[model samples]
Target chain A: MIEIKNIIKSFNESTIVNNVSTTFLKGKTNLIIGQSGSGKTVLLKCLLGLHTPDSGEIIYDGVSNKKMNDSSKTLLRREMGMVFQGSALFDSMTVIENVMFPLTMLSDKNDEEIREKAEIAIQRVELEKAYDKLPSELSGGMQKRVAIARAIVMNPKYLFCDEPNSGLDPRTSIIIDKLIQEITKEFNITTIINSHDMNSVMEIGEKIIFLVDGEKNWEGTNKEIFKTTNQSVTDFVYSSELLKKVKKYL
Target chain B: MFYLSDIGKYFIMIKMSFFKPSKWKVLRKLIFKEINDLIIESIPIVAILSFFIGAVISIQTALNLSSPFISKSLIGFATRQSVILEFAPTFMSIIMAGKVGSYITSSIGTMRVTEQIDALEVMGINPLNYLVFPKIVALLFYPFVITISMFVAIFGGFLAMTFAGVPSEAYISGIQMEFEPYHIVYAYIKTFLFAIILATVPSYHGFYMKGGALEVGKASTLSFVWTSIIIIVVNFIITQLLLS
Candidate 1:
């Protein structure tokens, strides 16, 4: 489990993530949803240790991130896995190689063991046959699966996916979301996803934090989202007339 | 202040690059890959350019000698002096500053734009150690490339002089005349310094570059320009300090 207390971040005199606090439970898909410029990415970056919060404490399972030294930070980071919005697979490496990279770099496992582990991760993502293919050869959805495989191959206790379903088709998006949800439950990992996709919110968001203009506007489960009285959350969630009508029916 | 800050940052990057690698086994592979990619692949171009430049220098020297008192062998002497002391090392480095330098900048910049560096960082890897250290290690072999250039340049000059009807015996005599072995040492020193510039300057540009594909192009161009300028300046300083 990860606990953040009063996290605040700013860049160039502009506050990007305002004072916010939340807890992300283990064995669940936690989502941070916000529109563009709503501090979703900035908040995620702070959580990932890519950006240090201007103030407040980020505690990972009872340990505060701010107090860790460089070596401790690296050790903590190794226990965490991240899937970038772009997938960020090494363009030159094959799918299997990409998945096995973290192990190859940080683990003492032999090559054969690493290969077996990578193959399993690839198979879990249903990409067993695409092991030798470069990232460029894969479609956007396939690339996301590769990224997911890479992220999970490390058996990370914490998983962070930044806009995993971006640019993907609806069916593929749902499949990716479900895969992440299943992986989170199976591994009992504390998974945090930064996304603005309503479909993702409704499908896999067991716990959701909604941000508006850098502040935490609302926080609830997917079911609570439809019934919430918060005007900003309702306005953003049901911006389309069709969604508004659906909300009325709900 | 910005310039001073950048200088500080660059040194910090250099300092960080020497950190203990997470896995030397993986680093060994990276070093070998960079050697093959950056050095071995560069040989053909280096060879072609060095040969032609050497031939041109000899031909030009022979043509300009109008004094009857001057010996034909002076062409060989001049070629040796020019190619060894400057052309083979400095000029060839300039060529590499374009070919290899642009490649380093654009590739790393693309990685940055695509967030691969972020991926590396989140994976508990120091991106600088993982990326730049191997290039620096591989480029330490750069003097080997320059040494090849020196040999080929002199041989090409000999061939050009021979074909142009300059007396071989006189040229050979000049080649053997008043040979200072320290000139080779000076050239190697310059080559080593140039190699450091080649590895770091472009990497600094690419690593710190912002924006997307267009910015990568601009960074590559800037990397080449700055690398060339630094090489020229360093060459002047080394020459003045060592030779004068």
Candidate 2:
């Protein structure tokens, strides 16, 4: 579990994430939903240690981020995994090589053992046929799966996905969302997803935090989101006419 | 102020690149790949340019020394001085700043735009050590490239001189005339410094670049400009300190 305590981050004179505190529980898909320029990415970067908060603290399980030294942060990061929006697979490496990279760099295991572990991760993602294909040869959905396989190959305790469904079709997006949800539950990992996809929020958001202009506007479960009377939450959750009709039916 | 900050940042980047080294296995592979990319692949261009330029230098020197008072051996002497002191080391490096510098920038900038650098950082790897260190190490063999350029260029001069009806013996004797070993040392020193600049400056531009695909192109161009400027300035300084 990760506990965010009033985390505030700013760039230059502009504040991007302001006094936002929330708990992301283990074995659940915690989604941070916001419109464009609503600070979702900034907040995620703060959580990922890519951006340091100007104030407030983030505690990973029991250890405070501010208290950890560089080496400790590096060690903690080794137990973490990330899937970028672009599915940032190394362009030159084959799928199996991409999945095996972290192990090749960090693991003390032999080559055969590393290969076996990578194969298991690839099989978990059902990408066995793409083992030798480069990322450019893969489709959008396949690349996302490769990214997921690479992320989980190390058996990370924390998984972060930045807009994992972006650039994917609705059907492929749903599959990616379900895969992430299933993996989170199976591994009992603290999975935090930054997304604005309403379908993702409703389908897999066990806990949701809605941000408006860098501050938390509402927090609830997927079921509770429909019933919430908060104007900002309702306006965002039912922004589309189709979603408005769905909310009416609900 | 912008330049000052960038200079400071460049030093910090250089310092960080040597910190927390990668595993020997990973580093060995990266180093070898970089050697192939930055060093071995550069040989053909160096050889071709040196051969033609050396021929030109000998031809130009022979034409200018047409006076009956000037010895034919002076053509070889002038070619040797020009190629060793300036052409082979300094001029070839400037060309590399365009060829190799732009390549390093574009490749790294593309990775930045695509978030591969961020992926490495998120995985707890030092992206600088992984990306830049191997290039630096690989370019340590740059003097070897320069050495080849020197040999090929002088051979071109030899051929051109003989073809121009200067006796082979006169041209050979001229090449051996008043040869200072320190001049070769000075040339190699410049080669080594230029190699590091070639590796690092473009990397700095690419690694720190912002925005998308269009910006990657802009960064590559900008890196090339900065690398060439730094190379010329450093060459001037080295020449002043050593040759003066």
Model number with the top DockQ: 2
Put down candidate 1 lDDT per residue, B34-132, tens digits, no spaces: 999889999999999889988999999999986889899999999999999999889999999999999999999999999999999999999999989
Which digits, one per residue and each the tens of the lDDT, describe model 1 over residues A1-250? 9999999999999999999999999999999998999999999999899999999999999999978999999999998999999999999999999999999998999999999999999999999889999999999999999999999999999999999999999899999999999999999999999998999999998999999989999999999998899999988899878897896777
**Residue B143 C-alpha lDDT in model 2:** 93
Error of 2 at B240 (Å): 0.9
Best by lDDT: 2
Worst 10 residues of 2 chain B by lDDT: B157-166
Candidate 1 segments whose C-alpha is farther than 4 A from its true place: none
Candidate lDDT scores, in order, read 0.94, 0.94
lDDT of 1 at B149: 92
Tens digits of lDDT, candidate 2, B1-244:
9999999999998889999888998999999998999889999999999999999999999989989999989988999999999998889998998888999999999999999999999999999999999989999999999999999999999998878888999999999999999999999999999999999999999999999999999999999899989999999999999999
lDDT of 2 by residue, A133-202 (tens): 9999999999999999999999999999999999999999999999999999999999999999999998
Model 1 in CAPRI terms: which quality? high
DockQ for the candidates, in order: 0.86, 0.90
